[model samples]
Target: MVPQLYCDFLQPDTTARHTFTVKPTELAYINEHLHHLNHHISNLIELRSALLHRSNQLTSPTYIVPHEVLSHIFNQANQMEWRSPQQAIVLSAVSRQWRQVALGTSKLWERVICQGPLKLYRDSSLLIQHCASYASSLDIRLLEQGYKLGAADKTFDTTTTVLSSSDVKGKLKALELQRIPSPQWIHMLPSFLRLESLSIISGHHPSVDLSSLPLSHVYLNGSTFDSLILPPSVLVLHLDDYFLDYAVILLRKCPRLIEFSSETYILTRAQLPPNLSNPLALNSLEKLVWYPAQWFMELASATGLNIPVINNLELKDSEGLKPAPFALLCHQISASLESLTLTYFSANDDWSIADLRHLFTFPIPTLRKLSLTDWSHRLILNAICALTPDEGEDGYTDRCLPKLEYLSISSQDEIFGLEFDFDYRVLNLVKRRRIGEDSPFHLDFSFCSDDDADYEAQAAWQPELLHELKEFVANRPVTITIKGGEVELDQLSTARFDDGDCSS
Candidate 1:
């Protein structure tokens, strides 16, 4: 279908040594042909789009749905919960009417979560255009892509402008920047007053200097931040893989801090800093979470800090942690701490069952909620029996933690095995606690497994436990929850729980 002149122009010449050496006249002819082809394609596309729109209007249930209903449906279809943008694009591509509706729905554009780097970098310009309108409180999650100069610079620059925009300044609520190459990215972030949460996850060393940013919650993971200079505006701070000196210094800065969480190996055999000999109490701090049980010992030795008001304490880490530090910690904060969560990475450590029993001997009178994950039945029995003292033929002594209301016990079903009467132990605790109290006590006995290979086995056991549990709480004001390996630990059931509440 080619003309003689066009065929001659298009054919590759073997005699020519250089490439793409077309004359000006030939280039102009090629351009003209391309223009005509592009126009023809555009006209065909418009015609096809119009036809599809008319067909959908007549045949689709989507056409019958009201705008408000459609908008709501689109909102759900758009993965706003995960802050995804692809679904919105699919919705917009359905037809002309759908495209208008999707673009008009401002909530769909609220989140820009680009998981892959190269795709995000290549499509940066178009993606911004799609999300720019009605993005009052935008949440942008950029994953590290290839480090190609052109794409990287363009992507970073575009994002910088977006973050610095007037609308974004007032409405941006949370920003998660993971593996973004430049630490200058932190400086490029203008002071976002509305920003409540910020997570900077990087593997490389981060040179972060927290200025007067109104950040209520800040989480830094896998960073080599040896020192910290935090603003007074911070309330809740979580630092993973940080030095003890840095944590102490940061805590000194945030006087009104409420909750603090950190994970570090420095505490395994950590020594106290020279300036931390004297006591420094944070009366306002209510929650203390530390990983690698050794950190608890380090924190105890961290005499500079006296977290008097700390009630919720969570200790997590691998095996081989001694109990002396835990005992010392409990003795220090036993008067104030009400909720205690202990989790072990591996179930190999003995953890001194006797040491665990000795813990209840201390005066943790205010303790109410206790969670033991991946612990043996002996430990569970020890924890429960610790509350109620066993007297011989004489009489029963006053129980420990008489005000205790909630108990949560979780472990791998495989580890617990079929030998233990987990149900009976929990029932005994419930009966003992519900003796005369007007209020009911809550007991959560949950079993976890690796996969669905044992789901059937776990399900079979649940009914029997549930049946027995019902009999025990028949007339008593006691709530016993016998859960199998079904309840996911991380997923939140409702909006009342924040991202921090769900994060590991």
Candidate 2:
């Protein structure tokens, strides 16, 4: 299909070394393969063009009626009331074609959820059946009562033996099960055939062997994965405290894994993974993420990942991090980091303004984009001033973040010189604290989010904030992202700040 494929046919194999160079059989075989591939390629191009044309034709807004129709559907889906989600499911049931379209579209059917015990279990089964063929990604969440059902059926659900028989279980490419009431339902999950990404939260554990699971990417949060075992096929893994043995098991069993993030635990105790005995390190690794851990620094020191330049390392719960070692790493990170994010953990009581200055002591000569959230903006500003090109300090006239251009901050106050002459730019900022505490503290962490459900009620979603944001959008191109609760922005050229108390 490619030039390389053609070239590969020309290359001599081991047989070519020992005998008469080119055999007619080899030539014929290669020719047949090439001819077959060419047919496939021609078909592929035609298919692609057809799909593009169809997509354009269908996506164009033809009528306001359709928009009005879809708006009510989405409104029902997004509603906070009890039957809202079920109502979303019911809307799809208006007709077989509608059901097919709604379930086949990955975004619409991605989240297969129902709260409490819906009388529509029969209808839910139909959705599961519909998704079996169409779903590329799946998120199955049960309401509290649904959780009870999962708990009641725990033993029956978490089994490979049962999953193989289930129709909806096989087509799950990326599967997420959230708020599972019981740990027993895991057995009923389908075995991994095409499954690549799997996330299980607050669910029951599986009892059977998962060696056949085709999982390549995994994320386990807020539940126990102590019983879950990933096959060596896993390439990327994410874990929360619910699963502790993930890191240790992967280190020992998963030789091909390249990316890993786990908040389970960072310790070198008796429970330390068997791989730690003489932990073999990965050489093929390119990216690593470790967030909000009590022993993050110690784990960093223990792993061989202290490579001179880590591609992009994030420090979440930065409040837990001590100043000295973090400063040391920041200096080293300057050598190779392309992007860095420092998210403040809620536990930080003594988080200081001085820590930012420490980064200035050593030039982050290679740093390009720096994001800081929840801390004092003045501290970061002071650091910029250090890199500031004063007449006597540097050979140039003005250079703050000489190589650094984009910055995202989430603090209450405004810090200046961000646009000071060096191609530097402010990307965005967001809120760090809850709304009940203070209004402007919401100005922090605008550049990012990971799901702020821990304090949704505390989030500032007031009509006023939305009104101001809408006004800003009217003036300039803007992106307003709300994840669970927190809101963030991209560029705030005209953001107004109210002077408010921001006590630690």
Which candidate achieves the best lDDT against the true structure?
Answer: 1
Per-residue accuracy of model 2 over 320-432 as CA lDDT, tens digit each: 56777777766755666677776653433444435545564456676666666554444444433443444444323234344554455543222322332111212111111
Model 2, residue 255: what's the lDDT?
Answer: 58
Measured with C-alpha atoms, the lDDT of residue 369 in candidate 1 is 81
Error of 1 at 179 (Å): 0.3
- What is the C-alpha local distance difference test score of each model? 0.61, 0.48
- How many clashes in each structure? 1, 22
- Residue 311 of model 1: what lDDT? 94
TM accuracy, model 1: 0.66
Candidate 1, residues 136-211, lDDT tens digits: the string is 5566655556234242477666766766766767777677777766655666554676777778775564455656
